[model samples]
Target: MGRWGPRLITLGVVIALVYPTLGDPPRDGFPLSTYPMFAVDRGPVTRVTTAVGRDADSDRVLLSPHLLAGTDEPIMAVRTARTAVSDGRSAEWCREVADRVARGPARVDGVETIEVVTETHEAAATLTSDAPPVSVALHATCPVSRR
Candidate 1:
């Protein structure tokens, strides 16, 4: 009986672990879950609000999150960009990004203008290919001085 006690408890716990899966439309519970987030239908393409730098030679360069929001966190920069556009303050945000670029890495040295824009792209292609964006919605533009 003593030896069987632990085995029975183990068996019960295992059963409980998998019991949630037996439900027809599995509902989330104490630990394991079928949370609604998983059932969400997000598509392949996504529109992202961001900042871009235009070089003197007509080339567009994507700026980093640091230039956008003073942080390395991408989500924070996205929020900052989106908020600026939605609030009609994109010009101000664009200047901030331009300022950051002027003081940032050498790769942005030739950049003469900063643009706040929303770009749409296929998530998979963006990650795995050199494909161009599907669309770009420009919101604001500002100059970056050599200072």
Candidate 2:
């Protein structure tokens, strides 16, 4: 009975760990997990208003939104393209998206920089805001490896 006790406990622990993964897709699915590592410090996230405006002369679309970083101070903006880190075509797509965002208007006063840290085809951007140094992560899905 002594040996069996430990074995049963070990089995219980192993099952607890595997059960969560079995029921759902991995955390980084097409729709990523809400409980990401970076969202911890973002206090009271009020959804920013966004507008998709068209540049008639350039034939381009712009995405303008106001993001409120926890504090009253201005936050540093980080923009990423989906294809930049992954595949070549995706990188081009991401660049287009980034370009559109760059041209878009921002209501908040101090948006220091809009950097493309990683190209498309790679992981999403993990941005750290300046106001209170809050971290926000953007996630995207890619093919899972069989091997």
Candidate 3:
């Protein structure tokens, strides 16, 4: 009976640890996967500015230029959008970029507004021009545990 008791406790502990991981959401839907790093083949310019704002509201705009290696032109840009709720600021930015890409090139006279909000920051912007399709490449920052 003593040996059985220890075995049961070990089993209980294992189940407790596994339960949380089993309930975790899929990685594909995660923000990290959604916002992938892009590789550009431009000139010496390794950084480009990006803006985010809403289609109707222009007062609250966010402009951020991320430092990227390997390109002169702004080959890739990240667009982050924030709402009053939801904790996924990075994912929202990626989603907005994807939506803009799907909508095709912006008109010379028209404006593409973007808005970003997070626990840390809020940004908005109105972008113009016919930008190319931004390609996103996903890389895992953390390694998977085998144990």
lDDT of each: 0.88, 0.34, 0.34
TM-score of each: 0.68, 0.24, 0.21
By descending TM-score, how would the candidates be arranged? 1, 2, 3
Model 2: per-residue Cα lDDT over 66-95, one tens digit each: 321112232212212332333434334333
Question: Which whole-number lDDT from 0 to 100 does residue 34 have in model 1?
Answer: 53
- How displaced is residue 69 in candidate 3, in Å? 27
User: Where does candidate 3 stray beyond 4 Å?
Assistant: 24-147
Best by lDDT: 1
Per-residue CA lDDT of candidate 3, range 46-112, in tens? 2223433333333433322331111233443322122212343444444444344334333311223
Q: How many collisions between residues are there in candidate 3?
A: 15
Off by over 4 Å in 1: 1-40
Q: How does candidate 3 score on lDDT?
A: 0.34
Q: Regarding TM-score, does 1 or 3 come out ahead?
A: 1
lDDT (10s digit) by residue, model 1, range 16-70: 8888777997777878755655676779998899899999996989888898899
Question: Which one is best on TM-score?
Answer: 1
